[model samples]
Target: MIDISASPTSTTLVVSGDLDLAERDQFPEVTARVTGLRRQLVVIDMCRVTFMDSTGAAFLISLADSSRNRGGAAVLRGADARDLFVLEVCGALELFRIDRDHRCDDVPDAVEEPSIV
Candidate 1:
């Protein structure tokens, strides 16, 4: 599941379960909504993600790229080494800011109104 929340300056995506080919169908709509927000920051909470394949990495890269193009930034919270490795292998690690110290619980309520999709 993916839950999106937004504040005036940032948007957060709380991702759970596996982010692989099976979840591909949801990526487009989620991407559109997130990019359309035009927020200055995008936070992807990956603490609950069990597995992520290349497709998931591509989705993350797309989000980071879009945010960068708009002069914003994308942050990945609670991402493990495996996730980072996937991004690195894809040559897209530089696209995001990895916050290894941050966890899902540390996310502020400023992103309180989540819309599940």
Candidate 2:
């Protein structure tokens, strides 16, 4: 099960859940939803994710690329040791900007209001 929530203030997408092959079907929809968003910073919360595979890694890479093409940033959060291992093994770690802070409680409070340039 995957849950995606967006912070209006920060324009960040907080995603939590298992992103293994079972949830691969939902990846396109998820990517579409984020791609349609006009936000500049997309922070994906992956803390709740229990497992991942090569397919999941690919999905993340695609999302990151799309975000970049649109002049936005896609960041991965809550990457536990196991998650990091998976990404390293898949040789896709360079494709993502992984957050190593492990600080999930401050996301809401740290969110800054959206701004226009």
Candidate 3:
């Protein structure tokens, strides 16, 4: 599941559970619901996401592109190492602005889960 909190200039998406194709069906609706008419910095907190597939990667790419088109940036935080590997293998790491070293000002406090379970 994903919990979205939209502020006036930013939106925080707390992603939980597996981000596989089976669960990506709600991605569009969730984004549409959380995104307001005005531009917003989209911060995707993947602290609780356990797994991800190629479909999920594509969804994230699309989300980032869509947000950028609206003059907003998309930030992915606390992505699992496995997911990072997937992106690396797919040569899609550049698509997302990974928030590791420097975090955007609008990013909410993201308590990352343990990578090893």
Candidate 4:
């Protein structure tokens, strides 16, 4: 289960989901769409992401590669501790722009629309 959307001004892709084996297939389509955008910011919002597997990690790496190829930025926001650890353990954390903000004690039930952007 994944919810993916792109920012209109920048090439930011907001993603929220489990992103494990069950939702791996949707990532490529998302990357394809985000990589073709005209903007330079590919911000992947992971605030609502609860799980991640090796396949999901690979998809993120691919997205980073594509963003770099286009000379854009790939920003990963609000990754949970476990998922961040997964990326670090896989040595994929350095490949993208990541923020480890866990200040909120209460996480939303779902990923809402990009109201901040």
Candidate 5:
């Protein structure tokens, strides 16, 4: 599941549950909505994510790449070692700004209703 919140300058994607091939069908739509925001900052809050596979890493990479291509940035907040490892193995760890200091308790209510995919 993912909950998206946006401000004029940034968009936050609060991710939870499992992120793997099972969730691939939802990736495109989520990607389009997020990228369409055109915010300068994209924050991916992954503290609640229990598992992530290569497909998840690919989705994250795509979001980061899209943000960078538009002169923006993508931030990964609260990613655990397992999630980090997946990104690392995929050679996409450097694509995002890792925010170790951010906490899930810091998330605000979604500006847009939470979308379960």
Candidate 6:
């Protein structure tokens, strides 16, 4: 499942469970809310995501690319070893803005409120 939230200055997407072939297509819907923002900090929390494949990595990389085009940044947080491996194999580890020190309360603007399901 996925939970999305937005603060004054940032948007956060928390993804748990597995991100394999079955879950790969869910990226667009999850990222749609933040892809158009400009100068916004987008945080994708994958700390709880148990499994991820190259498809998942590609989706994330694409999402991050889209955000960058709009002057926003996509920060990936808490990617475990398996997920990290996919990213590394794809040579996408350096493409994203990794922020391990991100704090939820630290927002800079007021964005639309997010939801969880």
Best by lDDT: 1
Clashing pairs in 1: none
Q: Between candidates 1 and 3, which one is better according to lDDT? A: 1
Residue pairs of candidate 6 with colliding backbone atoms: 8-109, 8-110, 9-109
Candidate 1 local accuracy as lDDT? Answer: 0.85
| Ten-residue region with minimum lDDT total, candidate 6 | 108-117
- Candidate 2 Cα errors over 4 Å, as ranges: 7-11, 104-117
Residue-level lDDT of model 5, residues 1-112, one tens digit each, is 9899999899999898888999999999999999999998999998778789999999999999999999999998878777887888898888988876665665442122
How does candidate 4 fare on TM-score? 0.75
lDDT of 3 by residue, 26-117 (tens): 98887676555445588888877778898888777777777888877888788757777777677777767777753333435444423332
Per model, state how many residue pairs clash.
0, 0, 0, 2, 0, 3
Model 5: residues with Cα > 4 Å off, grouped in runs: 105-117
Give the root-mean-square deviation of each candidate in angstroms.
Answer: 7.6, 7.6, 5.8, 5.9, 7.5, 9.1
**Candidate 3, residue 32: CA error in Å?**
1.8
lDDT of 6 by residue, 1-117 (tens): 778888888888888778778996677777676664443677888766768888788878887787777777788776655666688789887766665554334333312222211
Model 4: how far residue 32 lies from native, Å: 1.1
Model 3: worst 10 consecutive residues (lDDT sum): 108-117
Scored against the true structure, residue 23 in model 4 reaches a CA lDDT of 85
lDDT of 1 by residue, 1-117 (tens): 899999999999999889999999999999999998899899999877878999999999999999999999999887777877888899998888877556457534212212111
lDDT of 4 by residue, 33-89 (tens): 766665666667676677788888888888887877777767777766576677778
Query: 35, model 6: CA deviation in Å?
Result: 1.7
TM-score of 5: 0.87
Show the colliding residue pairs in model 4: 11-41, 12-43
Compute each candidate's TM-score over C-alphas: 0.87, 0.74, 0.77, 0.75, 0.87, 0.76
Best by TM-score: 5
For lDDT, candidate 2 versus 6, the one ahead is: 6
lDDT of each: 0.85, 0.67, 0.73, 0.67, 0.85, 0.70
lDDT of 1 at 61: 92
Off by over 4 Å in 3: 101-117
Model 6 ranges off by over 4 Å: 36-39, 102-117
Better of 3 and 6 by lDDT: 3
